[model samples]
Target chain A: MTISRVAIIGLGLIGGSIGLAVREMLPGVATTGWDADAAVRRRAAERGLAGTICETAGDAVREAELVILCVPVGAMNAAAEAIAADLVPGTIVSDVGSSKRRVGEALAKTLPGAVVIPAHPVAGTENSGPDAGFPELFRHRWCIVTPDHTAPPAAVEALTQFWEGLGATVEIMDPAHHDLVLAVTSHIPHLIAYTIVGTASDLEDVTRGEVIKYSAGGFRDFTRIAASNPTMWRDVFLSNRDAVLEVLGRFTEDLSLLQRAIRDGDGETLFDLFERTRAIRRSIIEEGQDDARPDFGRTDH
Target chain B: MTISRVAIIGLGLIGGSIGLAVREMLPGVATTGWDADAAVRRRAAERGLAGTICETAGDAVREAELVILCVPVGAMNAAAEAIAADLVPGTIVSDVGSSKRRVGEALAKTLPGAVVIPAHPVAGTENSGPDAGFPELFRHRWCIVTPDHTAPPAAVEALTQFWEGLGATVEIMDPAHHDLVLAVTSHIPHLIAYTIVGTASDLEDVTRGEVIKYSAGGFRDFTRIAASNPTMWRDVFLSNRDAVLEVLGRFTEDLSLLQRAIRDGDGETLFDLFERTRAIRRSIIEEGQDDARPDFGRTDH
Candidate 1:
């Protein structure tokens, strides 16, 4: 089925980029965008990200067949409520939300009339805003979808193909599994990045500047993660609070042990830890997740 | 005086890179290098990195007017002592060691007849060994010189000019100051990376693979640093114990505060810290340390 009319509820990086990708990859997709920031919506429309900018979520979802909700996790319910009444009976509501379960919970409660699917395209840069969005953001990345057990099979299949067409390898999994995997992989890492960058910011100016300059040694990557959309991460922590806290606890305990070993000058423990992690990096390289080059995905090639 | 004969003692990343850079950038500078691994020395000469492969540090330094010690911190003294008697009188000796005070102290005792200058060029990739060396490693980076007040002025000036000629902006500082600053900037950050990567590696297999796959989220940065020359970093932590421990203390306490804030669900505290860090990243960009593009140095212009 050709998708002509599409609604993007948040005109930020993910939403704007999805719209841009759809426009570029699928020629006739008519994107109608809505944003809390009116200026963002206007700019998105002006930049040809959307065919039209809608005045409200209600207006945005009205008559739209494919509605993409890209707002923060905390705002998903209200956004859902605002659009649910206006969503056409046959509309398929999808989200680019980080937390699938939370979005699924909101949609299950608020949008029973619509075919709701929770999606997370594991692709993005630290940049946010309509201008930062580009059509190629999703190319050569993974897009995971979590469909409710009771949802229509046709809707699930259509959404998978839609993402694949946008240059993503679609993986369907249970919402809980997605959360757990992401908690280890994406969520906990971002939380730690936020924490470390936060810790460094409290230091003296000269030290902090040195941290950034010599960041190539390791700290700069955390800075980039810490620079991510703050509001989005806060909600991620709050919504996925349990899993995040558990992982953070493990990380802290491990760090404490390493700190103690360093203080005691235990070369054995240090070397052991260093040696094992080489395997993890090796595994990533073998699995083709990481490029063999020094930089990740940042192809100097 | 023209640097007609240059001897590089140690054929690791820093030493080999220096040999390669000097060969390409300064065609007139004749170079000979030595490493414990004879095969590595042969490869260096084959790659045009050195004019000749010396059998020993003594052989390398034998009539060279400029002898550079490029061994690890712990090995600096022994390497210096081994070549001390073979050094030509009035020869200018310098080093590419990371810690200044320690290297300076060792060099002062080991090479009493030479004009010894301690220098550190802040350049590298995570990869090490002879093959890991690149000619452009020091280009456009900072190379610091820490000279004793009693040292010959001409020797210090010549060493500074050599680094400058290699495209490194030379900064002269006290040995103690260099140690303190680098501890905050480089050592502490590297220690933290090793700690975190160690944390991730200890996880169960299911979670471990996912960690690598989604490492682009942030953890990959730590992996690179964690993958750095272990023996070199082990020496750094052990040799610079006081500074590393002091910085680690501050970092740990700050990390505890973040842990508390997260447990307390203190959004404001988290927000304040996260926001403050963004400014440091901005400053790093302004300071010409980081690329200011939307996605950091990652986005290709």
Candidate 2:
């Protein structure tokens, strides 16, 4: 059950980073990778992203003890189906999807005989594609593994070890809870970023040019998050619909309260909320989740 | 009118930065500064934020040809009134307030004999206070000068020159328009950040510890912005109430569209909005408003 022969089925940022990290961290493990895009496969070869860049999904997973689908959440089921017939009967199947419940279901439904244990490595940059990854991308980051209770314990343990080998600290959680937590932590933040960026772009009185120039005042941070892969993010929201919608509802309600406070010129209400939020940021820095450097140590100026 | 003798009426990040920038860029011009906080004044003196750290606002403005109030928007009037008796009658009075219209009105009403011009340097870091000042904070940044139409041309021109000397590109804008533009670009973004951070913190199902640990996914960026000065932001939201409420209304409307899309599983709508925002980010980087570095070039892994 040790994940030594691994197959990576996406070759984008997450897949490519895993490939590079495995090469650097787990030298004994052999990696075979395939991408739906031929260009990504060629780039993976050029970057030496895997020990072998297989020409087909079946070819990639045929001998792999572990098959990790690294495609967008929407594409997970198709990827699982492609590898199903070729996967070794008891091969440990997993994915690097943002949302766990849907992705776990997709993998299980497609590869019924295989051990479908889904995980999400909560680490990435705004950039994507094969060229946007580096070996240290997952270092000191969280990798939440959401395995179905019916799945074999040995397979889950091996998958956890596999992620830990790549420099991530691993957390085990139920798929539903993972989705709910991430909805607040990742999904809604992105949704808000996309919305505000869109709102700023469509303003009648303010020129997009002006918005761009003054972005550093605060708008640019949202732009960075909003610039993340649209396809992946769109799939995330769609696949994790219930959790996302629930969180979005709460966010909207909270926003309305602030909106009312602003309209009423209630400085105390605004000040109280603003003050409460600061302690969490302090805890994030203390927990080593973010850099304490000012402006995130951006040297863009 | 030439502004050879300048006084800064607050010694926080903006005020301290101005003092340091003036010293670097206009060596011939002397600056005197005073802060309501005694400890901040001590730090300002140690950092040489001004040529002289005066004991009182009156002492700071007594011999100055120009006085810039760098306090929060809520305190602009009081800062103006504090220096009123000591300010030379023809002194060119300005401020670095986020909400220009209210600040402009406050300055005009309080120091009627002085040339009242309000300016907002649309530049900052999340870190504030005296120790956070750096001379290069304003370099390559936009400084919007909002002067009353009836104000003298010579005073406007002199104030423009003063900011330009500190390495900022100056744009003249109407105070009301400046408030609206900043509501979209700065105030609303901050409000959204604060709201999201607060929303995440209050989730009963998700632990605050988990939120802090997994923040690198996207929430950390919001936390950095939400960590900005609560008093400053409280004042901004209060002073720019009408504009902020208007922009917040628009933002909520836009967010609702995306929220509906998520609930309906409409990937296309989400993708379209997400894709549109990337271009604004590119423009911001191209215009030198934000650094083009990845993860804001953070090294604290």
Best by DockQ: 2
DockQ per candidate, 2 decimals: 0.46, 0.86
Candidate 2 lDDT tens digits, B1-301: 5879999999999999999999998999999999999999999999999999999999999998889999998988788878988888888888998999878887888998898988999889888899999998899999999988878999999999999999999999988998999999999999999999999998898999889888988999999999999999999999989999898889988888887888787888888888888888888888987878777877766
Docking class of 1: acceptable
Worst 10 residues of 1 chain A by lDDT: A292-301
lDDT of each: 0.76, 0.91
Q: Ten-residue segment with the worst summed lDDT in candidate 2 chain B? A: B292-301
Where model 2 places Cα greater than 4 Å from the true spot, the runs are none
